[model samples]
Target: MTEFKELYVRKGSVAQDYIDIAQDIYVEINNYFKIIDCNLKFCRMMNKPRTELFGTSILDAIHEKDKIKFQNIIRNALLKKFKDGIIRSDLVDYKSRIIATTMKLNPILDDNNNIVGMFVKFSSFRLRVEDSAVNTIFMSIYNSLTDLYTIYGTDTKIRINHVNTSLLNILGYTRDEMMGRHVADFLVKNKDQEENIKKLFKSLESTGNFTGEVLYQAKNGEEIPIHLSISSLVHNGKVIGSLGIGRDMREQKRLESENKSFELKLQNQSKLAEFGMMLQGVAHNMSTPLTGIKSSAQLQHSRLIKFKDKLAEKYGEDREISDNITDIMKFFELIDQSVSKLSKIIKNMMSKSRDQQSLSKEALNLAYVMNQEIEFLYANQFFKNRVEKNISIQPDLPVIYGLYSDFSQSFVNIIKNGVDAMWDSPVKKMDIVMYYESGAIFVKIKDTGKGIPHDIADKIFDPFFTTKPKFKDAKGEEPNGTGLGLDSVRSLLKPYRAKITFESGPGKGTEFIIAIPVKENQTDLNN
Candidate 1:
């Protein structure tokens, strides 16, 4: 057996060793936005030791007005939208003095090019201006305005005169390729955007500046969304050109899309929880009356049998009377069978709805639990009417232990997935088998529906990775394919130390096998 503690290793920080000697104030923040390390220059600038700065939120040092913008910058950087970006902001020093700084953000990526942290360099614009008038413009234009800077000649053609490195990188163009081209050649995204550009120029003519959202076309024809602010550049009290600075909106748009998706999934989950409560309540209310009906059925059954016997004795020679009595008894037997099934279903519902957060674990009969889930699924019209089910359970299986909801919920989710997978198939069938061996109970659920696609097999268990249609209505009661089913199964099985695996392929259908360890000390309820 491998010990849990042995599967780990420690690593040292290589960033500190390399960035410590750099002149600019450098800091590294993990993906969570916590400052993890900082160079000595950063420590001195804040007048705080590295100990006080490390592990703190970088947001603490950013001015309140720029916090949201800074956060979006970090999000976009982590998404690898660009190599590096520069933006201006006010930073709070250790003495709480506000310093205007131009900060550049660089994404630190792992071998797979996935961003793990952010590297930030801060240059105090105030200090940089103290050098000289010539160098101030040079540094501010090259360093401060590095995000998406463009200068257009304000001529009849509105020709581009200069483009910064950042703009070139974003547009995938060189200075030579972009210098003489009309600004509309890159800024026009569509006919609508072209009209918007006319409006922008109108605004600029009246106000000498325009700030709004627009689309910029890259060399490869990808439309890049950006928030742009443009101003008429003046030289000697005369307008010569227009300057444009833009912030990339790709990451912001992506985040909004993800947030919408999450909200839908959350709504679906909420509806499911509500439905569960309603079902549990109905089961609770019907349980007692259903049990009474079953009891009355049994008593009436015994009485009818006795009455038939008495009549047969009195009219032994009458074949008609005897035949009538036999028919009556058969009708009573059908009623009895139905009531018995209903009783079992109600019992299972009550058992499944037992408090899931109970303080103590209970020994659970795995076969019985599976049977209850199947019974509950049958309530679904598709499963009950269209699906053909085969079940085989080994006699006298050992008991597993857990809160009843954990096992019951996991089984239902897996079985429900099987049902949903087969919904569109010509042949809809399910096979379930359970047995015990080597102190573990195993249950297998197989379906004859369309199987999992090969490309997305690994992601099937990932939360919110559904191929289902987007949620459109809140009135729907079912899960609406939230993609949380399997991910939740993975979480629910942890308490039992259970393992679940599956075999699936397109058109061949899917089979899921779950192995749950049976602990000897967990048989209290079973006994």
Candidate 2:
């Protein structure tokens, strides 16, 4: 025996001792084992007679499907000289029962230190197989719940876990095509979208959920609007990833835009109808007085001329009578001047009324138009004594395309309101300035009189609203005005697409600014 010192006998005792200790462990572990040269307990664990299994290779007893895997484990153990090795795999036996197994391989060495075979221990695969089936069912249910679900790590990189046909159709991409792509890469055309997605993830890190509108591009180069809802998944109180769901909103947005446009058109038509009614009223009121004034002035002038000639001839030689005749002549001169002023007022009113009725548009120098109105205001005796009106038409102002008479009348109405606000106030000064800005024309009228009361400021433009006391006038108690001064002004301006705004403070002053969009045909006076 080459002085082996009875190593087999000692080893056998050691092995038997290990088998005794492992007997209790194997019972607790629910695992089976095989021994090549020793132990009745190991053979009992496999439910086989000791002679049938003791000398057989472990692979011969393993299920066919698992034999190769076990062999590989044994080979690795032999090559690496591993004391112990583990092999995990699934198998189905000749009886058609599924088995999920974990095999532990331990190398057995002879007394001379040469490798022998191996000790193989394994557990029945039934429990593991059932667990795997449950996992698959859970995954199937998860995928069904989410049409286009993806998990994003804290780093913002997308990890696609589930997607349905609806999501694939909407995105116009195949599942395999989108699997590993970055979420932002699909939104490269819209930088804002990428930035927003980044911000959304950052917010999710803190709050655990985020919901908002996001724009995405499809494979067809079309922009798709989506409502993205994200929720963070937490495990053990730490945010591991986020889940995202997207709903398409492009059709909804289109419908909303259409509704808005229709509403705007309806509003404009209503405003136009109201304007027509106001225009009719203004024309009717002005035409009557203008016709009467023209008739009266002509009749008075003819009678006065006849009277003046008769007096001069009768007092040809009488000095006192001649002086009286001269005084009479001066009186007629005063009447003539008054008639001329009344004519100008009627002309301006007629022009404004005609333009309002027609809504005719034209491009005119704003400065020239404003100056004309200011001159008329200055010439009127009623305004001259009570107010000092000054006009500064900016030389650099561009021409504005609008209804000439309508634009002028709007300015006149604003200025007239300024005068009316100071009817009984001590202060009396008005300044009109016209300028150009950013493709628009602006006319500003400021008055150094008591401004409108804060309580009634908003009501100033209401129909039939007035601060003036009703009174019977010389024209057979003129019917009370419909209080449509500002109302008409606002209505007339609608057709021209102009805006009128005012700022006022008690005892400080009131300033009205009228802005009209400049058309391309508008002449640039500055250029």
lDDT of each: 0.77, 0.64
Query: What's model 2's overall lDDT?
Result: 0.64
What lDDT is reached at residue 189 by model 2? 59
Worst 10 residues of 2 by lDDT: 24-33
Off by over 4 Å in 1: 1-146, 156-159, 187-202, 217-223, 313-319, 353-375, 385-424, 427-527
Shift of residue 266 alpha carbon in model 2, Å: 8.7
What residue pairs clash in candidate 1, if any at all? none
In terms of lDDT, model 1 sits at: 0.77
Write model 1 residue lDDT over 1-527, tens digit each, in one string.
01211111111245455456666677779999999878787787678899999999988888889899888888887786643445887788778888888887766656676768887778877567668587768856774554787778877425788778888888888889998898778875678898889988788878988898888899988889988888988999998888888888988887875576557656855675676678778987887787777677777778877887888788765678767867877777777788788767776766655543243577667777777777778779988998898899885787656666677778888888888888778999899899988878888999987899999989888767787655674235333577777877887687667889999999999999998877743656434
Error of 2 at 109 (Å): 14
**Candidate 2, residues 117-191: lDDT per residue as tens digits?**
554445555445546777788666755663456666655535554455556677888888877567765653556
